[model samples]
Target: MIINPELDKLYNVRAAIPNHTDIFADWEQRSVEFSQNVKGQLDLRYGKGPREKLDLYLASEKNAPLHVFIHGGYWQAMDKSQSNFLGKTFLDAGINVAMIGYDLCPDVTLRELVEEIRRAFVWLWNHAEEYGYDQGKVQISGHSAGGHLVCMLLATNWLSYGLPTDVNPIHSAIAISGLFDLTQLVPTSINAKLGLELEEAKLLSPLFVDPQNICPLLLVVGSDESSGFHQQSDNLSVGWGENFEQLDRMNAVNCHHLSVVALLAEKQSSLFQWAIRHLGS
Candidate 1:
């Protein structure tokens, strides 16, 4: 870890949350129950890789917009199973939800994980008609490392991806408790797993990337989260101005890194409601 005491506290999410394990355990149990109870396609392969599968939960038989959610594990730890509960909010609102998973770092470079996410979107677009979703309306949301990946997706030019010019694959995006500038991460203990250099971090950071067609960019972080998370969201909103028609940030009240994500499961949560509104528009 870096010699900076404050930086260590800021970046070490598990250390910050003493009971993070229990939180995740509950998440796993709840996610399993949700998956068993909900009816939709499970373990759908988005890419050829073993880890590049996604779970899609459709609310109704009729067509609706799709909400693509990415799970965060600092690009290493978690998978989409813990994220299945997130789809309930969108499903209750009569929307389809797809939770994406990617190969972790060290095993596969972060760059390749980004490509896998792009390919996941490619799969979604190609299968939209079959899935009974509106291809043009996709609202992207991610937490932590997933947030970073969401920004990368936002910056992507769909035309280069062979997407139709008339159709917009991404309508709006939300980054929840995300780390935007990864340079700070390289010096932290997490770098052991991320294996990131300052140069590579800068190259992939949404802060530096030029966004393609700006959508409504919403940045969010738990108020009780470490200062690093708040600064990441604030800084990205300031830096990615050109990529968003309107920019906003939500300081989730009395929540931490893990708890803030719980807000996504709450129908009345400002964050969840905000996502629903933007997705409908």
Candidate 2:
């Protein structure tokens, strides 16, 4: 399995490594187990639509820190249910995990998806008491398209959302193997589903946005990722400017875009443990 980093692998991760059944199988197996074995709420609606729902896994610690994970399916194909396995480790670390779902592309524009993400967090913050999670501190992490949405959330104006002005709803974030520049996808096969013209692509690209008021953010990409993927992660850190100095880093290491996020399933993996520290903060 010699993965050439410079190869012409497009944004579609599954295409690079066609045999991803094991990865998805492990996710499904773990997710189902965690969902059944753990005590949590499922299909909790944050918006009027049916797809705008979230799942929350509770931790032993009362008022535990919160972590929200968004699933990646290029904004069209996946659901929060597929990633419940992520909640297992966060729960063990005494952080509540909220897996959010959204209406997909074509049916709903990327702009609408962004608003859905914003509304999802706002719902979490407002209903923290019922969920038994701390509202004071929150961290976020997303893989692939989820990572893209994570950055938009980081750049969002919480105040405009009627969230507390004293503290940002998000305290820390990590975007794993995420696509930051939407324009890059315009010419790719994914664009057929995304339908992004140059203007729409630029308008939605988090890489081009300056997230000045955000908390600490870490951009990670797989060492075996395509050159385009690597470029996006690096550019995001640089675009953050001085904030990059605080947590300014882009981590590239063993795995491809798909496999990189699979590290989340390993409780002791560097990516998971590193995220645990962020939740503690």
Candidate 3:
């Protein structure tokens, strides 16, 4: 194995330490408060059973595209409330946005979390008219773990769930800093708490799965992210080939893992503009 000291340092920060809860407390607090002010119906029910709530943020205008955002906390941390700030930009662009929350790992298996996301999409599809969405214009975007979920949604077979065979809930996807290959993470400390085995890792990996029905996808990473992250993005784009239609891999200059999200708010950024254009088309 080739070892680059600088690359190793980037991947080994204190935040990379396993099960570090307090590292993101401040940002989480800010996101919760920001979500509260967006003004929309909250925790609308999808499943009849417990733990089936989803927060909705409707656009002020009618017939808007619905953007569903999933927050990233390595599948063990963060909440929907902490990602409320994300809806504002889409809302401003006359698009509705939904920030979904799911049960975290250890408390719930990764398989369960994936089911929750799938249910969330089902709910969105069933209630698209109520939320002023076109249903056909829905898009999925997420960061890190959220990114992985979005890709999974893209790969899901709608026919198996009784939905229209050609209907993909996600018209396009913007996956930022996603972990497409879970096998590489199996040896990491985080895998212990996640309880991920080699077989499960391959099964859950978006990279390993056949990319048969993907929409236009944008794979983004921070210019300053670790080599592992950079590699993951490259691998997914290359693996998908034609299925990864209109691929745009961006390197947000001078940005790091956390700060790179700011580019989403900057309407001028190529990534942000590309997303808007895709949704508009």
Candidate 4:
């Protein structure tokens, strides 16, 4: 696929951030340290696939709410290991945290990633009791590509997955620095491995899909990110308006794509406070 230079500039997050490498290194170092000390289970298999596993950290309180986080790598990069640092604040707040991992693109299609995530959630719901978390009090959050997955999960028909419609498993969701419209990525270099054609992109786009059940949804983007990202969040906020039981939006000040995820680590940030409030609601 031929890449569009302008579109590439708009969506290529690493190139946009001068200190992306440093940020990645910090995330890795912090995540590794966090994983070593946190009271949790690592690499818990949720499915038969090699990457269909999650790292779970339980709260001190019994039967606490579960806050599942999905890492973002444009659906082609990163994994659960780099995301463990995101669990600490929630864990300290007496909310159980789970960082999910899924197979990357080229090895697996975007559609497959969505399916695997749904399967992961089903596993979590089924085993919530054994893991000491309340299944009914589940909230989800994701960054970038993971944000796209969160929206996809919201659009999923729980009834088809053998879940009752009256009480959906997801109580609320937060998509930080999310890519909602896959169609915009098709011409860019980001879609090389994703191989998303126009029709498939539309089919996979969260903006085009209606939510299967009503749930509180929050859309967040970094103030310094490219217009493409801000548009993505704004478009979804408008497109999914009727589907969300409640909707909220935030622009993390002085932040870009990578730095926004760091706000979740900070206990006092508005992003953190807003997320915790909705998760508890």
Mark the regions of model 1 whose C-alpha exceeds 4 Å error after superposition: 1-4
lDDT against the true structure, each candidate: 0.87, 0.81, 0.77, 0.90
TM-score of each: 0.96, 0.93, 0.88, 0.98
**What lDDT tens digits, residue by residue, belong to model 2 across residues 132-201?**
8888777888999999999998778777889867777787888998888987777767777678888989
lDDT of 2: 0.81
Ranking by TM-score: 4, 1, 2, 3
- lDDT-best of 2 and 4: 4
C-alpha RMSD of candidate 1: 1.4
Clashes of each: 1, 1, 0, 0
Taking every candidate in turn, the Cα RMSD to the unseen true structure, in Å, is 1.4, 3.7, 3.7, 1.1
Candidate 1 is scored at a TM of 0.96
Q: Write the per-residue lDDT of candidate 3 for residues 67-87, one digit (tens) a residue.
A: 888888778876777767767
Candidate 1, lDDT over the whole model = 0.87
Off by over 4 Å in 2: 1-8, 250-252
lDDT of 1 by residue, 52-120 (tens): 999888867466888999999999889998888888878889889999988998899988999999999
Residue 12 CA error for candidate 4 (Å)? 0.6
Which ten-residue region of model 2 has the weakest summed lDDT?
1-10
